[model samples]
Target: MTDDVTAAPRIVVGVDGSDPSKAALWWAVREAGLIGGVVEAVAVWEYPTAWYGWTPPQAEVFDYEKNARRTLVESIDRAIGPDRPVEIHTRVVQGHPAAVLLDAARGARLLVVGNRGHGGFAQALLGSVGQHCAQHASCPVVIVRGPGEASND
Candidate 1:
């Protein structure tokens, strides 16, 4: 019989520099190891709406994309450590987090995201991005929950 697992599946995971998101990354790595799949770590960057009215001096300006890329790398290093066997591809996109994750998940075997993000609404059990992807992603979605969090349903 031909080995059906010959093809390596692609798993798209969202990272937002949050603890929960890092947990999701580690979970994705473990899952990829089991399925012999590759992980596409996608990090989205955009200036906060509050920054629309203010522009810093040229030297004081921030590089949002560069910061996002650094965050992604640090999260991966902290989560997966330096010795990992699975293939991981990192991507830094500019757009809404949910929209970016959904777009990246196209043609992917699975989509994984953290239950919450680094936002002010700490009371919110499910972050907007995770909720959106769970409801709208094309492939199977996995929302990794951090400690002390329980699913509503």
Candidate 2:
């Protein structure tokens, strides 16, 4: 018999502790459960570019990644809840959100993200990261808008 378990689809979802991101994770998990797939939750972070041409202290950089991992873990727990329905994985990376998600989505069955993230211009229909992934991801992309999220368009 073929090892079907090894071929299970992997859905990569970008989560940033936002309500919309949580909604995306919820949707991805539900879809994965239905398709007998796996969910990969990705969280990306980077030092502010304001400190251009200068790197932060090693401890500071390490602390940022440490905190990012912690937040990603908490976000996954809160989004998936106690009763996990599908096998889920978490990834924490340091880079632009769109770039990080795009890289993580390589070989993934699907790429999922929130319609809008914790970025400027909340009134826009799709946040920069979501829009970029939708246009450039190798796999299909799903943009989940949180409840009550209205758009100017």
Candidate 3:
């Protein structure tokens, strides 16, 4: 971590509005409070590709960002409640989940994420987001698991 007092220590966390992601957010908040760092909650979104060569309306296409931001806020509220003591900054980025999280983790002390997300492969131990961030993030990565989730490693 940077020792510069001018900058607030930051811990970046990737959130996908999933249960494990919410747990990761809460864990990050607690760690931030312990270390005097602020938590950066990042939610990534992109316009869905249309099937059968059909395109959605422009308004509908742009609504994903708004929904992502809403989801991030709700996750934060659910995890830490409205009167959280630690400072939390929320971001909605447009790109792949791992790429967006890596960008956000550039200057962070730690990058945190959930073990799995809303992907179809629910039985997997780790989802692509967690695996990618752990492998490629600039800072150290912490993969938070839910209460009932056990580590296979």
Candidate 4:
């Protein structure tokens, strides 16, 4: 929320290619349009920590960053479409989802995230990433619910 005339305000959003994330991206875009700001759609990826005995060689390792980028783009396309009303930036980072989002929201006008993501607890109202960002983001935060997401049930 700077007064600098040259740079448009920035609204950072966390996208994980999940339905909830898609809704969060859509809401971020519309909010940016309302404030004449730009959207930063961020997707974070990290190596799987569950594998202990079987480790893939570097040659056989999966391209997580590339897949993350593709997923982010696909989510954007599905959520906001090709015809964007406001400027949208996509960033793929390698780190914890909540930490990455909190860092990205630095100096931003606002931070947006989904109520839930691809977590093990399917019935949870808020996922860890969203909850962490809500508690730690330097700027204001918005947690958006995906289509047909129920509450008070």
Comparing 1 and 3 by lDDT, which wins?
A: 1
Report the C-alpha displacement of residue 153, candidate 3, in angstroms.
Answer: 7.3
lDDT of 1 by residue, 37-147 (tens): 999999999875646666445657788999999999999999999998799999999998999999999989899998899975887888999999999999999989876
Instruction: Tell me model 3's lDDT, rounded to 2 decimals.
Output: 0.88
What's the lDDT of the predicted structure labeled candidate 2?
0.89
Off by over 4 Å in 1: 1-7, 51-59, 148-153
Q: Point out the higher-scoring one by lDDT: 3 or 4.
A: 4
List clashing residue pairs in candidate 4. none
The models' CA-based lDDT, in order, is 0.90, 0.89, 0.88, 0.91
Please identify model 4 stretches exceeding 4 Å from their true place: 1-5, 51-59
> Candidate 4 residues 1-153, lDDT tens each?
556666889999999989999999999999899989999999999877647845456757688999999999999999998899999988999998999999999999999999988865888888888888889989999999989987786
Clashing pairs in 3: none
lDDT of 2 by residue, 21-138 (tens): 9999999999999999999999898875436657645643356688878877888889888899999988889999999999999989999999998886877778999989999999
Error of 1 at 92 (Å): 0.3
TM-score of model 4 (CA atoms): 0.90
